[model samples]
Target: MRIPRCYEPQPMNPGDSLMLGDNNVQHLARTLRMRAGDQVLLFNGDGQEFHATALEVDKRSMQVRIDSGEAPKRDSALQIHIGQSLSRGERMDYAVQKATELGMARMTPLFSERCEVKLNSERQDKRLRHWQQVAISACEQSLRCTVPQLDAPEPLDHWVRSVEADLKLVLHHHSATPLGDLPRPGSIALLIGPEGGLTEAEVQLAMASGFRPVALGPRVLRTETAPVVAQAILQSHWGDLAGN
Candidate 1:
């Protein structure tokens, strides 16, 4: 059976016995029904994977002994920081999840002119935590030792002006420029619009801030689907996805 992976946000050393967190404990003990002597993989977002054996397991808790740690070279060579416009319901969640699986280095939820999702401070914090957990879950499933950084939501204008990268791209269906024409970049900052799409002024503002408008194809893609397709194309072109 494939050993389940859990993310533990703490330093782990070989030979150290560690108590699993409540979330992980519940998942392993109740959900997975893992018992004593079952092996589990642990990662702390430190780009290292720890092999561990369950010493004790019950519905309430689980304790594991670390066997060893290995740092696998699984991270992508190209770094991508995406500025994704906030969408409603499962759309945003799907974008974050798929982006994490695609090896996005960082993601910042963006507020644009057409953005419809409204959240007060409390709801924003709640959503931030939820997205972080989503990224963690994706990491576990993708076997990514390092979890992608999910930044708190920020204005698109601010993100476009402040984000630094070797290359910056804003998805614009009207653009005649194709992605293949651009020079290869070690790092990229990508801007994606909301379901209603970015206003012409918003696109101009991003362009003035140094993001080049690039087209994926003739047909327009949904906000959530754009990031997945764009990142896959980018990764296949210049990142680790090509090798895989």
Candidate 2:
């Protein structure tokens, strides 16, 4: 059986004995029912993976010894930072999860004119933490060594003006430009609008801020689905998803 991979948010070195974090402990010990000597794979958001063996395990905790470490080339070569507008329900969660799997370098939740979701400071913190965990879980499932950075939710205009990248794109179905027509870029900043989509003024603001309006195809995609398709296309064109 493939060894379960766990995210241990601590320094990991070969021969180091480490106690798994509460989440991981619950997964390995309580959920998976792993016992002593069971093999596990671990990463700490570093660009490396460590092989480990369970030393002790119970319902509440699991301790493991690092057997070895390997630096795998799992991250995408092309960096894609997504400014995703917040959506209601599980849509935001789905976007964050898929973006992480697609090797997005960074993601910032955006608040646009048409955004339906509202959060105060406390709720914002709670959602940010939740989205971050979602990214980490995606990394584990996708076998990625690096967990993509999830930034706090910010206004659409602010992100469009402040984000840096070689190429910037705002998804607009009205645009005639295709992804294939764009020049290859080392890094890309992609903007996805909310359920109601970006208003004309908002699109103009992004365009004025250096984001080129690009269409995926004729059909308009959902707020959550746009990032998945956009990232896949960008990754396939210039990132690691091309050959693999």
Candidate 3:
């Protein structure tokens, strides 16, 4: 059987028994009908994963005995922080999910002029939690023991100015620059626009803040597709995804 990988928040020690969270209990016990002695993999986002077997299972809760810990080395060497303009509905979720699987180190959703989504403080918090769960789910599927970072949504200009990286790039097809011309950077900050794309003024603002305009190719990609394509290129050339 495929051992299910799960995200647990509590600290883990080898050879210890602990209660899985309520959510996990529901999923494993009630939903999946998983019984005692089934094997599972658990990680707490502390850069290691614990192999465990269910020790007890019941309607309300479940316990697992931690067998051993394995540290995964799958993270990209190139630390990328995506300052992506917020798109509405599932588009934003899609971006976060794919970007995490692509090995993005950090992400900040940006409120740009072209962005259509609007949120009050309460809604923003809820959306943040939803997006975080999306990323966590991606990590479990991708076998990444270390979870990617996702920050609260902020204004585009503010994020552009504050985001730090060895190389900063903004994807604008009109620009003459290409991704291959730049020297290898240990870290990269990539800026991508929303559905309608970034305004000319907004692009200029990012350029003023040290983000150089670069294009993935001649064709213009959708708001949700740009970051994934850009990340693949960067990782292939300079990051951990590169292979012989």
Candidate 4:
């Protein structure tokens, strides 16, 4: 049977005892209904996971004892940073989750002229937390040792000017170049737009900022789907997924 992995904020080490809190405690006690001596894996976003056994279960917290275990090997070789235009509710969450699973080093939610969703400072903060959790859950599911970083959301124009990537791409249906045309770089950045897509002026702005326009295929993909496909293709081309 597969033991469930949990993300704990506290530090973990062999022979250490820790208590689960908040939703994590509730998840272990209620949802998983884990009994004493049940095996579970725990990680703290530190590129290592602890082999743990539940020691006690109560209303407030579930306690576990960590055991000596080898850390999981890192899977991604080429680092990818995704700059994605904000989409609606579940759409954005899906993209963030999949990007984490695909081994993105960092993520930034961008605001383009054609974007339909707009957020104030408060809403942006809440969304950033939500996206980080989505990424965490994805890492747990994929058994990734490292969690991807989620950067603060910024306007398309400003973010484009600030990034200095070894390879940068802005997805456009009318682009002449394909991602396959470029040699793999140590670090790559992919910029994808929302449903209505980026305006011509915005495309020109991206181009002027040193971002090459790359087309995925003949058909245009949905905002959420585009990043997943693009990341998978790039990974298979030069990252760990290659030759596998």
Q: Best-fitting candidate, measured by lDDT? A: 1
Q: List the residue pairs that clash in candidate 1.
A: none
How high a TM-score does candidate 4 get? 0.95
- What's the CA error at residue 139 for candidate 2, in Å? 0.6
* Tens-digit per-residue lDDT, 1-244, candidate 3: 7888899999999989999999898888898888888999999998899999999999899999999998879787789999989988889999999999999999999999988999999999999999999999999999988888899999998998888999999999998886668888999999999889899999999899999999788899999999999998889889877561
Model 2 error, position 91 (Å): 0.5
Candidate lDDT values, in order:
0.94, 0.92, 0.91, 0.88
What is the lDDT for 217 in model 3?
Answer: 80
* Candidate 2 lDDT for residue 28: 84
- Residue runs of model 1 more than 4 Å from their true location after superposition: none
Model 1 lDDT per residue over 1-244, tens place: 9998889998999999989999998889999999999999999999999999999998898999999999999999899999999998799999999999999999999999999999899999999999999999999999999999999999999999999999999999999887668899999999999999999999999999999999899999999999999999999989998653
Instruction: Candidate 1: give its CA RMSD in angstroms.
Output: 1.2
- The global Cα lDDT (0 to 1) of model 1 is 0.94
Candidate RMSDs in Å, in order, are 1.2, 1.1, 1.1, 1.4
Per-residue lDDT of 58 in model 2:
89
Model 2: per-residue lDDT, tens digit, 1-244?
7899978889999999988889998888988899899999999998999999999998888889999999999998898999999997699999999999999999999999999999999999999999999999999999999989989899999999999999999999999987767788989999999999999999999999999999989898998999999988888778888663
